[model samples]
Target: MSDKPVAVIGAGLAGLSAALTLQEAGREVVIYDGSDRVGGRVATDYIDGFTLDRGFQLINAKYPELLRLGVVDELDFIFAPRTIDVCVGEKRIALGDPRSNPFASLNPAAGTLIQKLGLVAYLLRTADAAKSVEEELSHLGKLYSRVLKPFLSGVFLTSPASVNAVIGKGLITSFISGKPGLPRKGVGALPAALAARIRKIELNHRIDSLSQFENQEVIVATDLTTAAQLLDIANVPKLAGSTTWYYEVPQELTGSARLLIDGEHRGPVVNSIVLSNLISTYAPDGKSLLASTTLDFASESEVRRHLALMWGAHTGGWSLIAKYDIPKSLPIFAIGNQSAASSQFSNNIYVAGDYRTAPSQNGALLSGRLAAQELLLDQGR
Candidate 1:
């Protein structure tokens, strides 16, 4: 191998992961990012003493990548209940992870007793991996409408029918096995923890051409669009987008840490959370922070009304802290398509991103590790 240090473009989670993996293997690695921050799409904006993530994101401590990277215990993680609160017409339903809280989904609004039993049964009996999430859950009529659709549509940022069954499977298993939440510092703390281990990360330094890193192995760990542009690959998966609105409400108005979804599909906001309820540090003393996410952008008044409906409160006093419009959030996995998770782009040049994997932090980290390992093997290390 050449004596020159390995160059990693993009300081996102994928780039950070690749750089760290190579550094651990006794190789010199340097990272370059175009943005001022390191977390990429998982960034957090501190506005008026409130922490607003770039999008609605969660950190699952039990993700194999986070555990493997040994970042599970580094920061203070505020875990939400392993339950989803859905707002049906004129009523709210709480659905819990059957694996851990079997009785949590017992309410009639959740589904019939038989339907709840089928949820557990279907989870045990894995569906065909090459099916659409919609197809996989089509058997449970009420469960699909009342619980899963809104919950998943919020997370995936697209229709369930377009998402692969493998994604649905991953979601079910993670919720069953993992505790999903945000760090006390915010979701940005996740990538920050990973980047802390690596030595060199040059932010606001964009690498436009591969020829610049002369005589050095390079890893393009940028987003799917940038990665493809650098590789001159024209055909790539389409991207998904979302809009999130953050409001500062009175501290007196709060709810459970569980995520709230609009099951009735009555509004533009699909899901929301009382952020301060989950992590108090997200807001200032005597104040509260709330976030609502939607696939389509809605007016500020519309968002406030939708949030009020979900939280069952009057949001007239809620002030807008910040609003995020992320047009290229993640890749939309096609139905029946399998996990990409590929890093073997070329002999000397490699690519890593969630687009190459499953479109999660775990997938981003795993892709970086795979890229570094493949590069190491090719170099006869």
Candidate 2:
């Protein structure tokens, strides 16, 4: 082996995945993170006899690396029932099964004729595109701009139009196509398992900066904000922002995951509302659990008001398990002039995170793995 070792700079999904890949390839890998804990964004905290995830979180079977790790089986996943309620003004219609529901044929959004035809067109086009998964995702990216955007604006609690088409398509694939399964214990268990398999990890060491070495390789897997701090980029500072709330109620909320629209102008208020009992491990024998998220850019007052609307009457001292702004929770995956960070300095260096381009868990994981594989192959591993 060469004297050089690979250094993975973050312990989140990306960093862990990269480290694991490098380890498998027989590389001497050392993982570093600023946080005391190992799991980065896939955060789960135990509080008041409850497991609270950082934000609205879900683990889809379609996730390639997750499936590869076999952690899904170890956690004994509980499938969330295929359900979503899109609440519009006056009348709330269940979007039914994006796969098998006939509601689209009956109550399409536009005019009656247009809605019906649109529904038919959508189904036909979707069916046709389904033959090729990648093509289907590309097609949905286009539909996101047209159909899903206005509806998802409120669903994701942000402008769907602004979200990256690829990321939006992945979300649609997870819901309409992939099987949804959450950990039996909680999101924390998954990361804990990954950390166990990893070799060397340095916790509580915030990377102050990054400098190139002739033979050793450095992989910067931190979020944009942290990455900026290490790389000395002025624009990286602006990317730091995140908002999320985790609530551990007495018991599981008896229901399916609901996508609640504003019910007014239909602007994004909150993304998908999750019922944690769907994953039995989080809730007690008779209790339920739930977690929701808000945009990082929103002000404190704005978050409070949204919580009032979303929580509605359950605002009592319900054990605020964990609450804080991540500052760099997710990258802004919007259109034009949004933000872009890259590993352009040296061929020996690589950058991987949701901030690199796509801003989703899957993208982050895939980027990490890809960057590692690319580096390893380049080194003739």
TM-scores of all models? Answer: 0.95, 0.77
* Candidate 1 lDDT, 1-381, residue by residue in tens: 879999999888889999988998999999999889898998898888888899889888899988888886877887878877888766877777666667666676667788777777878886676788888886787788867888888878887888888866787677678878888998888889888888998998887888887677999999988888888998988888999888887766655777889878877888888888888889898788888898876787888777878777898987888888998988887876666645677758988888777878888888888999989988987
TM-score, structure 1 vs. true: 0.95
RMSD of 2: 5.5
Q: Any runs in candidate 1 off by more than 4 Å, and if so which? A: 98-102
Best by TM-score: 1
Candidate RMSDs in order: 1.7, 5.5
lDDT of 2 by residue, 1-381 (tens): 247778889998889888988999889999989898877878877766666676656777667667676677777777765555444444545554645666553554422444444434554443331132233333443233333554454333355545544454445555566667667666767778888998789998776766544467878888776777776767752342445655555443335555443433332245535455465556555656556555536554555455455434344545445665665555645533322344344677877776664566676777788788878877788
Top candidate, metric lDDT: 1
Screening candidate 2 with a backbone cut-off below 3 angstroms (N, C-alpha, C), the clashing residue pairs are 154-268, 240-327, 241-327, 243-296, 251-287, 251-288, 252-287, 252-288, 252-289
